[model samples]
Target chain A: MFFFKLPFLNLLRHYGRTSLSLVSIILGVLVIILGRGTITGLRESVIRGEIDGMTGHVSVLPADYPTSGLLHPLDGLYSLPPAAEQWLHANAVAWTRRLFFAPRLVSGIDAIRVRAIAFDPATDADVFPRRDWRVEGRIPETAGDGVLLSRGIARTLSVQPGDMVVLETRTVAGAMNALQMPVAGIVSTGNPAIDSIILFLPLSAGEDLLRTDGAISHVSLLLGRRTDADAAAQQLQELLGEAVQTTTWEKEAAPGLEAQDLRQRFLDILVVALLVMAAAGIANTVLMAAYERIREVGTLRAMGLTRRGVAGLFMAEGFVMGLIGSLIGAMLGAWLTFKYSIEGIDMTALVEEMGSGEMFQDIPFSSMLYFGFSGRTILLAIAVGMIVATISSLYPAMIAARKEPADAVRS
Target chain B: MKICEVESVCKIYGRGAAEVRALDDVSLVFEPGEFTVISGPSGSGKTTLLNMVGCLDTPTSGRVVLEGKDVSTLGERALAHVRAKRIGFIFQSFNLVPVLSALENVETALHLARFSGNRRKTAAEMLDAVGLRDQMRRRPTQLSGGQQQRIAVARALVKHPGLVIADEPTANLDSKTGTQILDVMRQMNESFGVTFLFSTHDPRVMERARRIVSLHDGRIAEDRTREKPSAAGEVALTSDASNESNA
Candidate 1:
């Protein structure tokens, strides 16, 4: 119908003005797409890093273990009973025991305080696969007395593999002790949190150094599939009894995810702000078009177009503009998401450049950040763009509709 | 039957100190097939009276009856219906929608009038009548002022309205182009028998009128009938009523 086609022609005739409105809508859609991508990507990356580097699919810790801060209390360390250990080995797909402690490493006169992870070298690799590890020397193996120093701590202490470093810490009995150990390898795992302030030691060495006999801080388990974690943890909890508490990776990662939620809230605010700005731009465009075409309104009315028809004309123009701009922006945003989700954004380089990788050690963080997006996100962007534009044009459309047919006589 | 009747119509603009009585108790009648010109100097109520008959505005007091119905009391919606189906307009500026081609401009009028018969064919034939058939696809901006005005004339006549109101339709054209426009309008009027009411100060337009209604100081000063333009280039006055009168 001519009524439907008229609005498009009207926009085409005034393309310069239409293009300005389109640009604003495009920017607003882009913000939405990128904002969602960033939030989803960050959340996924945190979960991935935690599952691979710290918690396996599930973890069994002492019932009263401290869940916050860098300094974990060593007194809570408990040795797995023979029955519990045998049941875990039989039931779990893969299992490993680990000890976490804070120690000060001294190389020559330089020293830095850091978190150290002691692992069962033989079974640790099965549960926690370390992919993309860059090391100068080889990692410590089963029963190996040598420690693997992270690249950042090694640099700070001015030490390399084959050098002896003294680790000073307190025993469970509250006695200060120091142990001299050989640095077997200096590694950069591409995880800023681990690389910057962590060191790896064999569990045997950790038991001997801390004089805790064979006790460990926790036992991490890997299930057949990620979805099996909750059931496996519940089963493990019944077997392990009340002395130990079984928790899934999701539960362990909750605190870090809260920070991500805060970021999501900020992104939500930003999305609103951007959309409002785009809507304002659309409103201004419609208003200016109405003002510029006053005589055209008069002529249209004189031609017997109802007031509603004139209003529909302007609203249709806005809707078309929003539809176009949002589609383009969504596609561009989606392309960027696909590219980064597969290739990943290199947070290692970013952290290294800023020299702030150590600050990330307190939370589950990864060096490669991947973005997230979906078809629903694109659809939502388009709908939002159209709705905002239509609403914004409402007032201007009314202003145009109010023109007097007698205005046709005016020059 | 009378095409339009204005019964003591009075139009006031603004309010209080700035109020203006643009048309003061002016009565006029237009017969079917009559090419009538309402001639006046500036501020002489020629346009105001045209507005009332065109259904573009309502009189402050009194009635404007178009095709047997009093339109002055009609609501906006009813007035729009009257304008669309019964009346056509041609402005001094030849106000064709610039975005549409000449053919499309004429087609729009048919569309507005809700013409049921072959709109495109009707529009094209109307353009052919105005001698702009070859340039029907060209936009208004692409055409000369005379051609644009011709297209406007085509648009006005294509809908077969009972009355066509043209306000200074030839004011924007040159003398030669103006005469061509006048010739096209006169030919259309004679062929279709669509009553035309014009408000203009152009002498060339006044010379071709079948009837001339002169306005002075917001009231009709003279209503006269004259013979169609003669081969001798002289207008022969058939009848003259030099006061508020009817044609």
Candidate 2:
């Protein structure tokens, strides 16, 4: 009881300094919780958006397709095994076939390379939701020269529906051919990889361009839970044999994962900077308190508190303050997480404020980014608070403990 | 039996050409239950001598025997332990912990000694003994100088220390309050048989001491003992002999 009493009473004596220290700690922890929580939520949400909207929960391609070349050949396509198709039908909630090709869209002096997906809209709609895809015009009709431009491509090419673009590529006959297509719509897939240089065309159009007879590049499967993606991929690979590679969305969305990792590193630095600044404030408070209470320290030493005991007293005070600050910060952080999770932080406004960049893609629901305060967020905040508070007080406590009794008591 | 003994103690400040001896072979012994005052002018080494005997400092060349154990060569931790367990100190500034109340201030010393009894009760009793029963909850800032000094006395005596050192304790208090504080210490000395050593320049304070040792140039010039002061310790103000002694 006295162990707590000594520090508690001492804290009451200098309430101002104690409060200042607590505020610094609380603010630091609050920032950490919010910052890390937002990032965690955002990264997870984007991954979810990618899986549900474009990449599906899993994708199956030729085993060597990943390393075959930057622009995987249209002719390298493998037909989906009947067993794999049966399993996907049994386990997957939705599925779609896509014909992928790397083609150049040419218009007068402008020509840009793009990864195009030829999809059957009726089935593709079931695999991917338009909620976040956000079409600016209309889906392509099955006939005529029709293509859907990604928002980025539409912006770069400055084209709207009814504008003509020339699609040029090497056909399976080893001859380069070109065809004119009228832009049908502009789409925002939310996944930066898909939006940067992606377009949607009728699978028949791609087949006509590539002369691949009727072969599709890969099949996308959506599952009830994303966590089941890896295990399902493994099951599909075994069922279909090793000739094809079945992969999760994380592998399929490599650039997004890398961007998330980079953002995570940035958040780590931000959290440390916040903690260091707070620690500096705590250290300063303890030092000033030590200087102010030199005589009291002498009295304590003369009274029987060992050098260790004197130091322990300060640490106890800091511990109490840190525990309070972290608890408050955790609650505030949790509230922020829940609040953002519901109402969401508007990414569209944030992107506009930040301006257009390669890092910030034009995903439709980029407008409302939600958040969650996971257990990891609160635990990290608490750890930073406790460690900073305790360590920051140690130097001043030791210095105070070293004060000479005679010098302090003299006058 | 002697409660404390300072044997031929010497203390010097600075080094080489800048050095000046603060104490030159000063020797003093405090008999058990004696109220001894070591009086001197400023810089006469009385405070230095008190510090050594209180075990707050160590002399350059001498032995300090506290409670029959020589603490002259003891390390800092050991000296601190002795200071905590056996010696109590009342400073000129009263030196009560400002954060602690009168009772807690007194309780602090007993706590340092690791006293086995009920700490709060013993502390309250000591405060009451010093006429602060009603003011036990007041902190030093809340109490007047006299009240704070009495609290300091309670802090010093509550641990039942063998030797209690007061260095010019009454210097900051007026004569009336000073006498009141002296009376409390004397009563504790009479009742509990606790030895006390004081370093002061006040003749009025010196007059109340049963033993008066005067110092000159860091050396003892005269040592005298009278019967313990009268019931009215304030009468020391009327004594001309104490005034002329320094002159």
Candidate 3:
């Protein structure tokens, strides 16, 4: 009790020095919180946008198809047997069939190379709903010479809904054929690559035009629960054997996965650099405070304080500094997040070079970017602050403890 | 009975040609309630002898017996325990912590001695006894040199230790203030039966002491007892008489 009062009063007496040290600590803590929060928010936003924009949780592709490597000539479409389809129906919650191929699209005087996707209207509607796609007209329901053109493609061809367009592609026998189909709708998917080059048609019409019978390029699935995606993919692979292949959304979207990995590595490097700088600032501030209080420490020792007691006193000071700094940093970080959450920071003018197309569209700094205060983040911040403070005080506290009573008196 | 007994205590500085013996073959006895002064020139080992008796420093050789316990054989922690409970010290510079009020400074000794219950009141009583009742709430820097020394004296006596070791207790004060401080010590000695041992070179301090031990060249030169002198000739008689008697 007697020992506790002395250090508290000492800190009060030297309020100027104490406040200076606290400010340095607060700046360090604020940097840590803001840096980590921004990086985490960015990663989460990118992942969520990617998942919702195109890829579902899991996808099923042909076993012979090398999805991750350079595209070689495809070895025809493979079909899932009745038993496999039954397993999918029983175990999977949502599934769709996609027939994708690169071909030449022609409308009037405009002719452009494009990628075409054929899917079942009923099943694909549950996953990538036609309502969410920006459309100039209604999507085609029956599969008879009907097609959907992307907004960019519609502009290039000077075509609108009810206009006729031609698609040219090689049939399974390697003969090129052209088929004229009516434009049922023009879609704007907001992604530049998808907006400019993608066309969608019904499965039966795509099969007839390509001269294939009941064969699909791949099947995409969305499990009832995301966590079950990986396990379902594995089970589908084992059940389908070597002739068939199964791929999950994470694997099929290799570019997105690689981007996420690169982002995490960059964030790790940045966090380490910030922590080192913070520790240095804290150490320097604490060292100065400790030296200034040499006489005070000596007096406490003379007043029957043990060496442990002396160390505890300085440790208390460090702890208080860290705690106050962390609290201030949390408040500052939360305020920044809240302020930006309501009024998003627009990057459209800044990123004008990336084009104004919907695909290369500006991502508003929305409330989605606002970080929620989880218990984990708070605990981690406190632990980091305290650990840094304690480590910085070790050298200074040791110096305080080793002082000689007589020499201190003389000084 | 002797409360403190130092026998053949020696404290040396360096090795061989650079050697300096701060206290060489110094032996002394301090009785229970006597006000004794150890006087000497600057490097004559008076402070060294006082440190050994106060259990603040251990001798290089020989023993310091306090109340029949040989302190030289004890470990560092045990020596600290002895210092806390059995001995009190008043430094020449009035080594009170600058952050603490005068009352808190005095209460420190009692706290270390584990004396509980009404500690502030007891500390106030001690400060009043030393004639600094009004200055109890002021810090050491706020008080005068004489007032700070009086607080030190109060700190030394508040724990009611068997012995109080004061090193140059009047070194930083004026003659009149020093005398007033000494009068408080004399009163505490008479009223509370607290033994006082001072290491000083001041003639006024020596005159007030009932027993005087003089040191020279790190060794005791003379030890004598003085029958209490009247106030008028006390300083002159103690100085002149000690010189003639020793010569």
Candidate 4:
């Protein structure tokens, strides 16, 4: 058939209009790709920071601990049996026990509210390595009257390493207890919330200050891979039964993570909406072109071209438009991503307002982003373009086909 | 054999009070190898009658028989099939697709006729026959009026259609160019045994036709045959022969 040459030459002949439409489609596609990609990147950074800094892939807590809503005073730590600890040691790649509570720290006239975590420095190293976490000084070598204060809290108290700090908290019997300890370190994590409020102490010192005897809050476990976390959680649930609650990192940090997931979903919806709008614009452009060529269509029809052939010509034009637009958009999007990925988008001012030290501080942008480019997206776009073009051509093609050859001759 | 037969054909437009009868009880027969012209002013229904015979339009009543089949009763697909296989059309404006070269436009018709293999070669052959082989690669816009008309002729004849319908084929050209186109049609009619039906108002085209049918007010005003030239190449008038017989 002479179909191949006609549509291609037609597009070339009307290069101005075709190029205009191609620009619109490319811009639309670029917006979708960049918008979705940036949002996903942000969410992933947050999730990785939270999971790696605090909770491991999975954590086990007391069975009586409330799973939903805010934690109450009655929600005490879980006490794992010897068998349970042994089971975790055998099954998990890395695991640690932690005692977590909110307490008061006092230095002279300064008093600050803080979250204190008691962890065995040796076992916890595999999960939350203290060496990289410490901004100054170091983790206490042994269980002694020593504490590590986040930089923000340390600044507020005008205290440093070797300075005496007082810690106070309520016992299970509802009585307040206090202990004087030497400041062991002042840490600065880039996260403002964590840097300003967290106070870490040796397990034995936390035991003494809180008046708790050898009791722990939770056992957090890290698997070799994130994929193993879910299955291990399920296995822990079955083995521990009703005596303990086992949760994956997703469940433990559901609130913060859910918000991130919602943002991702919104980006997806926006991308799809933009694509649909672009498709409509493409349909309109092709339809108008078809209308302008009514006489040409009539000529082809009178020459014995079938209705299908006439429609196919227009559809092929649209498919070519889609292919060209998508290629240009992908390249443009990748160039922009590369340009910005290196310098990064600064949100420091915005981050300060949100009570974080740096909102997106030098996001170690991955050298390559995974673009889910399969035959499916390209094929679908082509199919949609063709269908839209064919449908839009129907009225004009039919009008041409039904025209009297005599009328065409008269004109 | 009758190449086209229209029996009791009626074509009406609109409804009731506003209805216009384009063709009323129009019956005509076209014989093979004849150059027949249907000439009339605008709105005399000449074009409508031609469309019905060409299978481009259907009559509201009666039947149009083309090559032994009743075309008026055929569905759109079947009508298209018949048009593709048996009929070719030349339009006055030379409605060649502007995107394609002159050769490509002619080859398109051959493609539709299902002529397989070496379409371009066949198209060039048709163009060569029309004395347009040199201009085959030029687009329609690049060609002169007479050249475009020649390309249109090549397109119509590429499919070897048994019948050729030219609807005012010379309306857009000058008198000289129109005469050249008429000469081509006359030569094709004489050499190929293809039936020719022209709906035209050009006196030159009418004079060249072997049989002239004049239409007025939706009816035939006159149907006459001119006398054939003698072997010595002298023109003879049939009216003169009739008057001599009366004397």
What is the lDDT of every predicted structure here?
0.85, 0.78, 0.72, 0.71
True contacts kept of each: 0.63, 0.57, 0.29, 0.57
Report how far residue A11 has shifted in candidate 1, in Å.
4.1
lDDT for B53 in candidate 4 is 88
User: For candidate 2, lDDT tens digit of each residue in A1-411?
Assistant: 456777777777678878887888888888887877777767776676667655788888767775322375765676776877788889999998888888899866888887788887768888876666678778885847499998778888888888899998888777999889888888865545456677889878888888878667788888999888899889988887777787887765566557767988998887788778778877777778778888877766766567777788777767777777788888888788778877776565455455433544323124457786577878888887988888888888888878787786552
- Per lDDT, the best of the predicted structures is 1
Give the least accurate 10-residue stretch of model 4 chain A, judged by summed lDDT.
Answer: A360-369
Better model by DockQ, 2 or 3? 2
Q: Which stretches of candidate 2 lie over 4 Å from their true place?
A: A1-23, A62-74, A89-96, A100-215, A222-245, A314-327, A351-367, B231-247
Candidate 1 ranges with C-alpha deviation above 4 Å: A1-21, A78-95, A102-113, A120-126, A162-182, A202-215, A222-239, A268-273, A353-358, B16-18, B115-119, B227-247
Which of 1 and 2 is the better model by TM-score? 1
- Backbone clashes counted, model 4: 0
Best by DockQ: 1
User: After best superposition, candidate 1 residue A115: deviation in angstroms?
Assistant: 3.0
Residue A173's lDDT in candidate 2: 72
Query: Stretches of candidate 3 above 4 Å error?
Result: A1-24, A42-50, A66-82, A105-215, A250-293, A330-374, B102-147, B173-180, B201-204, B229-247
What lDDT tens digits, residue by residue, belong to model 1 across residues A231-322?
88888788778887888889877877999999999988988998898899889988888888888778778878778888888888788778
Clashing pairs in 1: none
lDDT of 4 by residue, A294-329 (tens): 777766655655666667777766767766776677
